[model samples]
Target chain A: MAKKSEPQKASPKSLDVSELMRDNDQPNFLNQMQEDFKKMMIDKQVLQKCIETFLDEIIDQLTLGIIFDLHRKFKTKAYCLEVKENEEEADAEQSEELPLSPVKSSPQKCVCPNCAQQVAALRFARHLAKCMGLSNNSRSSRNASRRAATNKEKGASSSSSYSANSDDDNDEDWNPRMNRKKDKSFSPKKKGTPKRSSEPDLAEAINTDTGETDEAKNLRHTRSNSSSPDSLSGSGNITPKKRDKFKKMGKGKERSSASTSLKFD
Target chain B: MSGKPENANGRVSMHLDVNNGLERVTELIETRLIESGWKDRVKLACREAITENNQNVPSVDHLIEVITPKARALVPDAVKRELLHEIEMIFSNIEKGGYTTTLDG
Candidate 1:
């Protein structure tokens, strides 16, 4: 029993020595482990921050690259033309590139179905208006202003200018010649222009206001040598005031030439 | 030029096929891109390409050529990381013999 107690005491002493040794070592080890852990956590956070920043930089660079690439790809010479004032350079370049195709600058030509005359496609509508003798004063004035504006800008094209002059000459010639023929007789000319001669006469009938009904209007139109109701009906909308003006102008037949020329010009 | 890694890649892809993992990854990437507004950004870029030309609308092929490289570069890193992680998971699953059981099931 005494031996067990003595050994128990000795064991306690050994345990105390071991405990003291462990106490000395533990704090240092634990502090080192804590420091290491803290360092690892900080490192992880820093690494994450670095990666995020890198990603952001990469995205920005890519966006910039995309913008530059798109700008380079889509910024074309034609796009600049809208903002540019001068088109002569482009025209000169085009002319140089297609020196063999000088006729490209000229307006296209088509046969006027009514007059059977070759007319510039650009001026074909106006030519048709005069050839059919369905001239509306307001519409013609608007068209003349539009044509003059186009002519000012397109003055560079010689063929278009020449076509414009010829078109004016033909319009004036047709007006005077048709008036002379109608005054002499109601005979239709070889060309289709005089077939429309009764149009002016129908305007005169409407201006005279001899009819209030369609049948009466038809009777008056037929009496004026207009056999076609279709042509009469088409021109029937010419206001009395305009027709009266025409009649007032027609009182002086020789002076009507100058007036008609001035009206068209 | 590769030896073992190429075999590993092939095996990983084969495993992905077994698990229908490739399609899921693709769907995930597409969803991520859409959620991140990357798709809208790309669409805006395409519109800009079309409208910048004054004379005529640019050809589809030309637009694609101009935009494709930048679009590829613009994919978010998070999506790329998730995709790479998914691939790693596929590889690990293959290594763990999960491929056989999944194929069997």
Candidate 2:
């Protein structure tokens, strides 16, 4: 324990600052400081060099990236321009060839008669029907307006004819040419009405009103004249006493025809 | 060395553990770059270079060169230095084992 204590005491005396200063330790301390400075400078230079190299690497990478990006952008732009140019050239060629071709280039379209609008041929019928319906509505509105005007102008005289005229107009809407024929035939009936009030003449008038053709009217007239009770009984197809019954049957047929015509009127 | 004997199995396992650690570090870095939106730009640079050269694989130095600027831009100086140090350490270890790293282009 004494020996350990003696070493401790000796260590303190060896570290005496005044004694070391008297022996001229100042130069040695300065030299040590200079050496430390040199080492620090060297360390600083090394660190600077490392930082510069890192920065240079970063710059080189950035430059390479920019170069690659520019190259790709230019390549894509050139490709797009080429494609656009090719398309333009194709269009120009087609336009030039169109006039040179022999076939007439009429557009596939039709004109709607009702509206006078040009439409594709495939849709023409549908468009025409729609336009016609529209026109029909307009015509019906016009007719109603005209009826109002005529009612104000001719009041009582026009009322009786108005019903017949409206019916004729509706029939004309379906077949204008047939209505003209009916109008011509109707003129003769108006003239002939005072001349007869017999059954055959009444039947003929009913047939005309029903718009029967001249041939059908003539055939009906021949049948009515030929189908007498005497002729039917002479043929002996039925019993002789049944002649009166046959006459009654002919009258029934005429009545039925009259009823059908009345229904139509 | 203090805890266990330096056997062949131990050496192989250490190497595998180091490789796994390096892979995880790389994944973390990639995730950071993607989050920063720099991954696509780096990948584009690498892709263009690879395609122009008609290369199937890129050198590690080339990949680092293409990615370093973007990495520097996205990461702080201290973090960038730490990341570079980690990458250097991984490369040094791989070199020490005489292993070559192959990256697909």
Candidate 3:
């Protein structure tokens, strides 16, 4: 109508204004954009999932600070709980069986009120270290005080209840006065009688087993257990030959064994 | 965030995840759709890069803490500190906001 106004809409083949769709870079740009969009979508989803998991973990950790050892095995996985001191003392008398072994092969039917977990006798020291941060340094200082108390009591009484029970233990308190009794150096061969270092000989025993052959290890292990208080004390005042073997083991255990066995014997 | 085509020629980009606060995760995506069936160079490169990261990252867990602040907080103290310096140098520049390209060339 308007007399071919604006020139009749150009034919499809004869169009000039980019044909409204045939721009050179549009498809390429679009294809790239589409790929990017897909990747971005996947990444965003993964990120969201991660955030959700992280939040869930935080909640679980905070609320469930402690957990129960469902299986009564220690080596694999176990968690200990912190309970009140009063609970410990109150239960002491109730625990009639004593420390070495309890009436139950497993723990009592009590759960740590703070964190619901079953306690184990073997892992109690480790648990105390972790949950309570009770360090070896504290133990050492406490031991020093204990030795001082023993000194005071040793003067007052000839045979205390503590001494009666553990008569075999070579006395750690090497009160310089006892050293004068040279023949009584180690009644059981007066081995290398080192003093009370609470570092468990168990670690040493385990380490020795790791290094040597099976036969050698068995021999060493047997020697460690059999080396009595007498053997240790006497070993401390040993010739160069026994001392060589003593060095291979440890000083403290051997010495304490040698000296105390001789004096007490 | 808007990654303004950092390594377009190399077919990789140091992209920032917008949801995350500018974490410079290296992304290598193919622009051309492999004329039906071609060797995917981009995927190969990505695999190699990820492999490289795997080799280096674990050993450097401890060092990452002093160097890469976020990573340091995540990892434990007992971890070895080998990877810290290299990663720290990378992130420190990104933090400064001037350098965009991963390499000089």
DockQ of each: 0.02, 0.03, 0.02
Strongest candidate by DockQ: 2
Q: Give the Å shift of residue B68 in candidate 2.
A: 2.5
lDDT by residue (B23-84, candidate 1, tens digit) is: 56445556676788886687577767778876677765677577777676667777867655
Indicate the residue-level lDDT of A103 in model 3.
41
Report how far off residue A4 is in candidate 1 (Å). Answer: 86
Candidate 3 Cα deviation (angstroms), residue A215? 54
Q: Across residues A1-265, which tens digit of lDDT does each residue of candidate 3 receive?
A: 3223312432322333222124442334324433543453356444344333332233223222111111121113221222245567669866754764654465654433322344565655554443332456543343445445555655456555755523422344332223335425656433323332322354355435544445554455557756543233333334768745654555555545655665774
- Of the true interface contacts, the fraction found in model 3 is 0.00
A1-265, model 2: which lDDT tens digit per residue?
A: 5323422432321332223223342324323323432342346444344433443343344445544554554445653476589999999999999885744555478876643557877777655554444335543453344435444545454666766755544443334334346445766436333323344554444434434454554455456666554233232334545744755564566666765664564
- How much lDDT does each candidate structure score? 0.50, 0.46, 0.35
Query: A29-141 in candidate 1: lDDT tens per residue?
Result: 22332343234234544434433333333344445454555455455544345435357778878878896575577668989885478888878887777655557854345
- Give the better candidate number (1 or 2) by lDDT: 1
What is the C-alpha local distance difference test score of candidate 3? 0.35
State in Å the error of residue A212, model 2. 11
**lDDT of model 3 at position A237:** 36
Which candidate has the highest TM-score of all? 1
Write one digit per residue (lDDT tens) for candidate 2, span B3-93: 1112322222223232344246545555544565554565555556546655244554565665566545644456556555654455345
